[model samples]
Target chain A: MNDLTIIITLIAIGYIAGTWAEKRHYRSIEKREREFLDLPAITIKNVDIDDAKVKNAEIVYGGAVISVDYFKRILAGLRNIFGGSVKSYESLIDRARREALLRMKTMAPDATMIINVRIETSTIGRKSHKKSVACLEAFAYGTAIYLKG
Target chain B: MKYTARMPETNVNVTPTSPLREFFVLLSGVIAIIVGIYLLLGLALNIIVPRIPMTFERKLAGPFINSMASVDRSSEKAQTAQKLLDVIQKRYAKLPYTFTVYLQESPRINAVALPGGNIVVFSGLLEKIESENELAFILAHEMGHYVNRDHLKGVGRALVFIMISAMLLGPDSSAGNLLAQSLNVTEMAFSRNQETLADEFALNALHGTYGHVGGSADFFIKLSKEANTGLWGHYFSTHPENLKRIAHLKNYSRIHGFAEKLLRNIPAIINKKRPA
Candidate 1:
């Protein structure tokens, strides 16, 4: 094909791909919202599930890390460069951070002080070859004081 | 083909792109974008509004704790407040739950109870309020918290969140597990059923304790305005929607003439001191 014809074809392909990607992103959000809202009620059959150490006023915390896979990280890095906001990492990082604090607090409920917290992320053990799943690990720690301040 | 000079001028048919096609394409693109945005916003608004209570609690906890820590509790108002609480408590002892009142020295006007039996009335609330009836109404509403054991429920709801997260995200990842545990969504988004329950409980206690009809409803009306102005996040966060609560309170006022008078009396009492 001539240059003019080739340019027209490329433009068409770009439009189609952009439309498809936009639609796919919307579909994914809808799916995520559905799953999040549909979560079943997690009942505690036994109330004593609270860690004994927390009740005793001892400090404690928990951590975990999951790999983000190559593609996701590249996209995340691109998003971060935009500077205004990074919403993709929001759900992933938000979930990770909140869950860590919760477990530690539950573990040391009576403790008043929960300080010296730390969080880290890495791709060291990530199965790079896998395309379906991404992973990251987070760690949290603090002193738990059982005082009613 | 030999007559090249004479046949040089030849028309080449080019089916030029039509403006109509351009218009329609642009129209479709705009429509697609509008529809996409509408759907996304609708979904988010639905989820966000319903779960606001969970967000409210999470946001309020730190501020409340900080405020509590900063206030001085050594004021003499504590004794007087405790006395008033004793009288109110004794009168309502026939009810299902015990009521306790704490006189906090903070300057902000507020009184509330935590899940379990923790009740607090800010000195600011007392100082800013106009009359004994208003104060009594506030106390009664807080007492509703104890009767319902809302503090314990608050804690229970937080725990439920942790459990839910654990179930959804396998227990293997410690970081995910810990982060999930930190969120206190239950406090922000009380089940719609729970919001209704608390309102009913407070309304019932209002009548039982004060023998007045409109006092509680009147307070709600005032509170609704404050909420709209974004001045009362404490009440806004914990209580049901201000307008909804006011409407329910109005309904209660309709059934009880005494409450209607009390409601009417409130504006008069507050207004008597001012020109308007």
Candidate 2:
């Protein structure tokens, strides 16, 4: 019975706090994304820009690690039993990758564009020896291009 | 020059789902499935439990009872209980089980009828037994379980989930543990009917052994007066309410014309010493 109470408390805290945090984060992400709209981040390895017009190109990368809330963890656990898409984890991965891209764009304010952009994801921060979802990491890396007028 | 950066109007990667809604839907689905299985298995158990042969039962029960094999089985308290149990089994109950009593040193007043003819008697209940007839009633009540195989029915339904969770989530997983526990809380159907039948059997066993149903309700009479708050709660939960059980016992004994005779004293070796 004590374990039951603890699980319920954790799930409640997770849902309440996880939703609030995700909402605030998405708001901030949207605002930062708009601010960085001028700096295009693309997956194309090469662009049509002439070499003569290029200034300096440098590697810019950013990574974000997001942990799942208890509610989502339990939801995913149930999904594991029933065998279906883990919708609860979709938002966590979405936030991590978007946040990483936003941070990567923030690092190169004056760049004409970011090309060859790539995002990598992996699971990390698992504290127990048993298989479990603890935290996820999203890394966004690209070559930032500066142009000479 | 025409490359104007704009956020995609929709997030294709993340589904715009209400996590709460999904959580609840999936939660309810799983609960419904479990409840369905519980109901189905409960019915199946009634038909299947009796067909389970005694040899196979002892084999399946080997691992569980073997663990308690190391516990003291030949203590003075154990021998007395076993002797009384043998008398009740041979003369009155005549159950197919070769009943053996395992005296566990616990402060809880409960006796459990495990699979494979093992009756675990706790020290606290030993202390509560004022007469040999009352002790016989407790042992006989457990023997009554063997008569109807209520113990196996209760455990069989609960065991299905325990095994499934262990197979799917591994034995040590908290989720698995929780799943087993939730089913156990709901599936242990020691229903009022089973309890009443057992009470009736115990009354009959008391009459056969002593020629009178004397001191059959004394233990429950004592239990009701005590503060049954902590460990005492399990006994009450698994069995019927003390008052209801006592009432049923009286009614059955009166209908059978079994009178309360002089109570037999419990052996001194089986009694607990009061702190002076």
Candidate 3:
């Protein structure tokens, strides 16, 4: 291989080594991943969803997911900087809407169907997404508890 | 008598400055005003920007040493004398590698540390002092620089100034306008809290090593007297008057009862030699 290829390989190795070292050091200091003991209610800004009785009941469990392809589209939108339609992140928003439903489904006691479901959407800047990269990668989650009548 | 034939020197006959000359003068005056305004704006921006705390150690100290050449020519001697000073430093080998001292042959009774472990002391300060404890106290204070990582923090702050100046004003600005951003050669006078912490650290070292907390605190009182007049008083741009610092030290020793404690623990601690 050429000298440039060799140098690039070395740099890649060094980067991996450095990342590993930092990970190891932090792991040594604090070995356990902190458990999530509490979660706050999620809501769209300004608009209130009217399911207060169901929502007020303690939420038990919830999850969110987006197609891997959809995630790439969202990332591309963020990278476009001064370009691209930010609304393409709707996949993430949809996932969050689904998770909110799931949280209620899991928490509710033998509940059949949930009603008065609502979802709202907004666009965040490219910089904001970078600051919360883990959250940006997929979708969001929330829950609403309910009882089967 | 022909009035037209009158030779020179008549006030009325003086040639009036031309309209073109007047326009050029007005243009020059306007240009000068614009330049002055630009410089003032740059200075204002430099002051308003806050310094960031990044780990820029060597880059900051290198330029500071170069700048000190204008104030004192014997920086080379100062650099060389660090080896001799290391003999004194050897007494505290348990301390980390970061603690160091440099002796510059300057007439001013000043000692300061650059960001990173770059400590510079004027030899004149040593000449003026009578006791070894006084020298140890000053060195210990500078050691506080290394322990507290003052250099790294200070440089970080200065870098923030440079970045702001580059962003708001062009980087290639005039020297006078940038002087506000320049890192002063003396260790930036730390806050009262920081000063107290350093003094306390030195007091501990004094009591622990020589069993002489009184000597260390008394030296501060002497320096406080010296600092009231001549070059010493003028040196501090930010630190409180030395008398105030001395008063605090005396009170600290009295309240802490350092001397008696030193006497109590001397034999056991001497044999053990605890890590500083």
lDDT: which candidate is best?
Answer: 2
Give the C-alpha lDDT of model 2: 0.86
Q: Candidate 2 at residue A98, lDDT?
A: 96
Model 1, runs deviating above 4 Å: A1-149, B1-74, B93-98, B105-110, B162-195, B226-228, B256-276
Q: What does DockQ come to for candidate 3?
A: 0.00
Distance from true location, Cα of A87 in model 3, Å = 38
For model 1, residues B98-149, the per-residue Cα lDDT tens digits are 3334566555556666532346767656655655555556666666555544
Residue A122's C-alpha lDDT in candidate 3?
35
> What is the per-residue lDDT of model 3 for residues A1-149, given as tens digits with 9 covering 90 to 100?
24335534544554455335434633432221111112123343322335543434432444443222322342343335434343334434444444444444445444322333444433333354443322322223334434333
Per-residue alpha-carbon lDDT of model 3 for B1-276, expressed as tens digits?
Answer: 211212224323222333234334444564455446544544453354224232445455667766765334344444333543354355542345443456565566667767646677776565555445565566666666555555454555555545554553357544324343343422244344556676777666665555666456554566666655656653444445567777777777788786532222111211222134
lDDT of each: 0.49, 0.86, 0.47
Query: Considering every candidate listed, which one attains the maximal DockQ?
Result: 2
Residue A31 deviation, candidate 3, in Å?
86
Pick by TM-score: which candidate is best?
A: 2
The worst-scoring run of ten residues by lDDT in candidate 1 chain B lies at B1-10
For candidate 3 chain B, which ten residues in a row score worst on lDDT? B265-274
